[model samples]
Target: MAEKFTDEEFAFLRYARFGSLPERVKLEELVALNETEPAPDYSDLAYDAKERAEG
Candidate 1:
C-alpha cells in the first residue's frame, strides 16, 4: 500500500521539486521564443514504431 501525504507534506514536496525554477516570464517573450523553434520531426519515430509492430 502507498503511504498518503498530508497537505503540508504535499506542499513541501511540490516546492522541493520545482522551487528552483524561474517563476516568471513575459508572455510576449515566451511567444517569440516559441515562434523561433522548428516543428518536431517524427518520421523516424513512426518508422521505428512500424518496425516494432511488424516484428
Candidate 2:
C-alpha cells in the first residue's frame, strides 16, 4: 500500500530530504519549476488487471 500526497506536500518532502547538497540548487528556481510543471496523471493507476478493465 502507498500514501498519496498533494503536489505542494510532495515538493516540500523532497526538499526536506535533499535540500542540502554541494551541487547547489536554488530554492527559488525549484519553486518556479514546481509551479510550472504539471502534477502527475494518476487517473489510470490500477491494482490489477480487473481494476484496469473496470476503467
Candidate 3:
C-alpha cells in the first residue's frame, strides 16, 4: 500500500478484487449493468387518453 504499488503488489490487488485472471471487460460490464441511468425518454408514452382527446 505504498504511494505506488510495485508490480507484484498491483497484480495481487487486481487478483484479490476480481479473483484469478478475470477478464477486465467482464468486470466493466458487470459494474455498468449495476449502474442506474436517468429515467430514459418517456415523453412519448401512448395511451387511450391521447386517442380520446383527438376523437
Q: Considering TM-score, where higher is better, how would the candidates rank from best to worst?
A: 3, 1, 2
Model 2 residue runs over 4 Å out of place are: 20-55
How do these models rank on lDDT, best leading?
Answer: 1, 2, 3
lDDT of 2 by residue, 19-47 (tens): 84477777766753335666555653434
User: Could you give candidate 3's per-residue lDDT for residues 5-46 as a string of tens digits?
Assistant: 799998899988988874467554664346577664555445
**Cα error of candidate 2 at position 32, Å:** 27
List candidate 1 stretches off by more than 4 Å: 20-55
lDDT score, residue 9, model 2? 93
Give the top-scoring candidate (TM-score): 3
lDDT of the candidates, in the order given: 0.81, 0.71, 0.70
Deviation (Å) of 47 in candidate 3: 6.1
RMSD of 3: 9.1
**Between which residue pairs do clashes occur in model 2?**
none
| TM-score of every candidate relative to the true structure | 0.35, 0.33, 0.36
Which candidate do you rate higher for TM-score, 2 or 3? 3
Q: lDDT for model 1, please.
A: 0.81
